[model samples]
Target: MRRHVPGVPLQRWLLVSALVSAALIAGCSARSSAEGATHYLLTDQPTGSEATATGGEGLLRVQRIELARYLDVEGIVMQTSDVAVRSARNHLWAEDLAAQLHRDLAQRLSNQLEGVRVLDPDQQLRAPEREIMQLTVTVDRFQGRFDGYAVVGGKWRLLDSEGEIQAGERFQREQALTQDGYPALVESLKDAWTSVVADIADGLGGAWGR
Candidate 1:
C-alpha cells in the first residue's frame, strides 16, 4: 500500500499563479521603458511662404563632412562641466548627424546664394566639365553647454575648381536657449548654424568676385 500526498488548495494555487504573472508583466514593462528612446532630426522648420533664391550663379559642391569622434555617435551630447560631458541615452538623432549637417548646409546655402547651385558630392550631382567650388568642413564642437547655450564650432575650407584653397576660416557660435529641453537646444543650434552659413556665404561672395 502507498501513502497519498496532500494536494495544494485551488485558491492557493491560483494566488501563486497570479503573483507570478504580475511579476513577469512588471519585468517586461520595466524592460520596455528602458529600451524606448526618443529620436530627433536636425531639419529646417518650414517657412510660411516659399523661400526665394537670393544670390549669384555658380556650382558649389559640399564635400564630405567630418565630425569629432565624440560627436560621431547618434546620441545628443552635452557638456556637463568644464571637464565633463555626457551623451543622452534616451535622446538621439533620427539621422546621421554628419549627413544631416551636410544636407542642411547645402540647402541653406543654395537658398541664400542666388543663381548658385549647391551640390552635395555624396549625391553624385557634380559635373566634371562645369566649374565647381568645393566646401569641406570639420566640426569639433556641436553640443549643449551647462550654461544654457548651444555651441557650434568648426573649420570650413572653400576650394576652387583647381583644388586650390580659396578661403578657409574657423567658425564658432553660441546661441542661448530660449527655454529648456531638447527642442530648444536644437533650435538654438539651428540658429547658430544658420549664422555660420551666412558667414560662409559672405566669404564665398567675396571669393567668387560677386
Candidate 2:
C-alpha cells in the first residue's frame, strides 16, 4: 500500500471546468461582435409595359445616353409631419430624389436594352466617340399636398452629337395617399420617373435611324 497524497476535491475541479467553458463561450461571442458585418439587398423595381416597342428589329441593341448635371426645376423638398399631428415618414429632399432617379434610369436601361452599358460621366468625357446621345432631365415639381396627394412633374430633351435637339417631352404624374408617409411619397415619385423614362426611351428608339 502507498500513502495517498492530498488532492483537490472533484467538486472544485468541476467548478473550474465550468468556469473555463463559460469564459471560452464569452470570448467567442465578443470576437464575433468585434467583426464588422455588411448587408446587401435588391432594390430594383419591376419593368412596365411602357418600355415595350410596337415593331422593330425584334432584337434590341444597347445604347448609351448621357445625363445632364443640372435641371431646371423648383428642386426637391420633403414634408414629414401632418397638420393633424400625425407622424409622417421622412420626406425626400432634392438630392435624394436626384439620386433615386439616376439609379432608376440605370436599372431600367440595363433591363430593357440587351448588353446595355451606361458610361460614367467621367468616362464619357475622356472617351472619343463619333456620335453620342445626351438626355437632359429637369424636375419641374415634386411635392405633397395637404390633402395627402403626391405629385411629380418634369421635362426632358434628347440631343444628338452635334448638339441638335432630337426630341423633347414633358410629363406629370400624381397619386393619392397609399402608404402612410414619406416613403410612400418617394415610391410615388419613383413611379412617375419610371413612366417618364419608359416613354422617353421608346420615343427615342423609334427616332433612331438604321
- Kindly list the per-residue Cα lDDT of model 2 for residues 1-210, writing each as its tens digit: 112223634443333333233323433565543553212111356564324323332222223333233322222233222331111111114334455566566567545544324343344433433355666667655554434455567676767667687787887877654655345555565666667778766765565641
Candidate 1 lDDT: 0.72
Residues 80-186 of candidate 1 have per-residue lDDT tens digits of 55676666665679999998888777777776776666776865643355577899999999988765578999999999878899898999999977764677777
Model 2 C-alpha RMSD vs. true structure (Å) is 21.4
Q: Which 10-residue span in candidate 2 carries the lowest summed lDDT?
A: 83-92
Top candidate (lDDT): 1
Q: Which pairs clash (backbone N, Cα, C closer than 3 Å) in model 2? A: none
Clashes of each: 4, 0
Which stretches in model 1 have alpha-carbon errors above 4 Å? 1-35, 45-57, 122-129
Using all chains and alpha carbons, the TM-scores for the candidates as numbered come to 0.75, 0.53
